[model samples]
Target: MRELSFHGVTVRFGAGRSALAAVDGVDLTVPAGSVVGLVGESGSGKSTLAKAAVGLVPTTDGEIRLDGAPLRARRDRRRLQMVFQDPYASLDPRMTIGASIAEAVPGRPGRTGRAAEVARLLELVDLDPSRAGSLPSGLSGGQRQRVALARALAAEPDVVLADEITSALDVSVQGSVLNLVRDLRRQLGLTMLFISHNLAVVRYVSDVIAVMYLGRIVEAGPAAEVLTSPRHPYTRTLLDAAPRFGVALDDPVPADSELLDDEPPSPHDPPPGCRFHRRCPIGPLTVPERTVCVEKDPQPAAADRPHRAACHFASDAAPASLEVPAR
Candidate 1:
């Protein structure tokens, strides 16, 4: 298992004043053999970061490292593969599933060897090997996703970047896909960076959770700690917004904990200081001391700390009401 690290990674689109920093100075690490969940709302740059990792998008600055070395060569890039959100769009409609998977297998293995490998991969994803002969159009949405995973694994990559792999599936089938992800991680010791906006889904599959907002990670920690005791106001708001069963309609919302309904600032010209201060429930809008959040940018926690939040008041205790139930 090789580690994937993003050191001050920045991905900008366009040029001059109109440029948009889709992924800005993101410093994150997916530890060897572990799954790190990247969670945030739409337009938070989650997909851009994942795309940059696989060379789909260019980085304006910073470096992406695999196993402690800069990842630049095309050969080295094959070690990292991606499973995108839309199964139908990602797969070739004309190619049989077997042929698609076979195409990813490195080195020109003989026809017999490639066929056997494709069957093995299909079975690994719990798909019938016989279905490999069928085109993607012949499969259901969930089945096509499984085939996509099979193709990524066909490359024998050390790390997989799964970008909202379940969001496009039916809610009923989402659980099965998520379960498959957990099973594959365990069975193959797969290192992954799973991106999603659904906190509940992220909580279910992630060992660690990193919360992104306006192109920067605001909070990250062990899943249990971040979910149960979120430090950033944005993180807390996300948890509160998630659907909770069995809670009475009259259940009191925590004081000063409601997220502002306004849309987030544009990435093309993000606000100075803390980008989230305008929407932060506990920020300058509510707390006087939090004025610093508007005057200065809060840096991430020291590298030695395992659980960190990039906020001046990160040490402040979260409300008990913010705790989410364990899956």
Candidate 2:
């Protein structure tokens, strides 16, 4: 497994005054042989950061390293492969699953004996090798995603980027796929970056979780610690909005706790100070806190060992229970 590192990574779209920083000066690392989950809402730059790692998108600033070597200069591009969200779009419509998987086997392009390798990959993903001849269109959504994962592994990638690969599948299918990924990581010691908006899914599959807001990471820590006792307010807000395991069904939802109505400020010219200040539920309540929030951007600082948050009022204490009794 290769350690993937992003140092001050920044990706921009368009140019000049209209330029938008899709991924702002972000520093992240996916430790060798561990899965790191990047969780956030849409447009939070999760996908862009993943794409940037494999050189699919250019980084306007910073650098990406694979096991301490520059990602681009490395001769073997197959060491880092991505499994995208859309299985159908990622696969070749006309190609058989076997052929697709075999084609990705590094240094063996169009060579004989690929059938054996293809069958092994199929088994690795828990798919029947007999179905390898089936076209992508003939397979179920879950099966197609497995095929995509198998194809990515055929290259023997040291780091795999699984970007919302199960989002489009049924809940049952999603569980199966996630289980397969978790099992594979344990068995093969595969390093991965798992991106998704579902906090539950992220918690299940990741050892570490990073919460992104706008183009910055607001919180990052051990999956259990961050998910269960989120330090950042944005992390707490997300947990409240999602269907948590401990949240009671009869709990009264706070009327004032809904997300901000306005869309996030444009990344082209992000809001000054805390990018989340406009939507921060706690910031506006106090004068001094509001002043710090509106006047200065909070840098990610250590909250605990291996845990960090970029909030002025971050806490180590577990947040209050979201299960409020109905009035």
Top-TM-score candidate index: 1
Locate the minimum summed-lDDT window of 10 residues in model 2: 318-327
| Per-residue lDDT of 150 in model 1 | 95
1-327: candidate 1 lDDT, tens digit per residue: 799999999999998999889998999999999999999999999999998988988889999999899989888888999999999999999999999999999899999999999999999999999998999999999999999999999999989999999999999999999999999999999999999999999999999999999999988899999988887778887877787899664554432344467889998878777888887776766666657888888764524333567777677546663332222
TM per model? 0.94, 0.91
RMSD of 2: 3.0
For candidate 2, the per-residue lDDT at 235 reads: 79
Summarize candidate 2's per-residue lDDT along 66-158 as a digit string, tens digits. 888887764555689999999999999999999999888877544457888898899999999999899999999999999999999998998
Estimate candidate 1's alpha-carbon lDDT, on a 0 to 1 scale: 0.87
Which regions of candidate 2 fall more than 4 Å away from where they truly are? Answer: 74-76, 109-112, 249-256, 285-289, 300-306, 315-318, 321-327
lDDT of each: 0.87, 0.83
For model 1, the superposed segments whose C-alpha errors exceed 4 Å read 254-259, 300-306, 321-327
Q: Count clashing residue pairs per candidate.
A: 0, 0
